[model samples]
Target: MDLINFWLENLPTMIDGLIVSLQVTGAALVVGIPLGLLLALGVQAKTKAVRFSSMAFVEIGRGAPALIMLQFAYFGLPQAGISLSSFAAAAVALAWTTSAYTSEIIRAGLEAVPHGQQEAAVAVGFTRIDALRFIIVPQGLRVAAPALLGFSILMLQATSLCFAIALPELLSQAYMIGTNTFQYLPILLFAGLLYASICVPATIAVSLLERSLSKHSA
Candidate 1:
């Protein structure tokens, strides 16, 4: 009853934070997924310069911590007087981070397609671009779905950065409630459970997607 009452009292704040977290995650996915596919394709280009540059970008983004990226987006942009909302900052940072991972997944998926399939498409009068668009990406996405969704779960976790920039997110809200109620442990535990609740469904969805792909491949 105490735990229930505590949660009920803090529900509004927590819900607000959850909304922000979801917004960051959702916005990042909306923008980053397609950009990630393009980056993967660019990284595989025949031209050494294009490929190398794309790979370099991916490596740099992936290697850096998401918190560092959030800090950069939050502080670095202001020096140029190009300030963004915390939501914008969070979205950009999360998307940038996710794009790097997604690019790798996409690259691997593309590679997983048998070389013979590409050759067959070429023999059937399909241009490289057309073949890639029609035959390759469809198959590649199936291979990549599990990884992509897994990355999204990661990105969702990463959205915890909203606190640093003063944007209320789930963790931030929990922190606020804990600060007020002096029940830090319980608040944090509840917050963690909420995050896990969201992640579990996503993880299950990815597993199901992988199974569906495997069935199709078989």
Candidate 2:
């Protein structure tokens, strides 16, 4: 009963924090996915410099831990005279991670497209850019959608890493409440439930979408 009362009192605050978490995830996905697509194309570029630079970025982003990236953004940047608020730091760091990982996913999707399709497009007098825009990119993105959605869910969960930087996300809010009330287990459990609530449904949806896409392609 006391725990219920505590939850009732803190629900509003928790919801606010969750909203921030969602906003951060949404912002990262919006910016990161497009950047990912560009990096995917760059990875396939014929120019040596562009390909090497893109490869370096993708490797570094995938190699570094997300937590380290968060710390670098929030703590390390100030040493170089670039300062950002906690939210901005968290968003940028997570977006960088998202872009790197998703680039590989997108690249795989692009490669999955048959070479014959490109040949067909060219034989039809389509320019390379036009073929990519009309024939390749759309199909590739569709094939990649399920994986991208799964990654987005992972990115949402990754928002918890922002707590280290004192972003007022769900985990941070729960930690603050735990500190005040000394009810660490219950508060943390509630926060876990909150994350599960979103992730569970998202996982199911992604699975369904994956199956559907597979069947459609088959």
TM-score of each: 0.95, 0.96
Q: What TM-score would you give candidate 1 relative to the actual structure?
A: 0.95
lDDT of each: 0.88, 0.93
For residues 1-218, could you state the per-residue lDDT of candidate 2 as single tens digits? Answer: 98888888888888988999999999889989999999999999999999999999899889999999999999999999999999999989999999999999999999899999899999999999999999999889988999999999999999999999999999999999999999999888888988999999999999999888888873
**On residues 1-218, what C-alpha lDDT tens digit does candidate 1 reach at each position?**
99888888887888888888888999999888887898899898999999998888788789999899898898889999989888888888888888888998998999998888899999999998899999999889888889888988988888987788887899999998898889998888888888998999989988988898899893
* Predicted structure with the largest TM-score when compared to the true one: 2
What's model 1's overall lDDT? 0.88
lDDT of 2 at 93: 94
Model 1 Cα displacement at 1 (Å)?
0.9
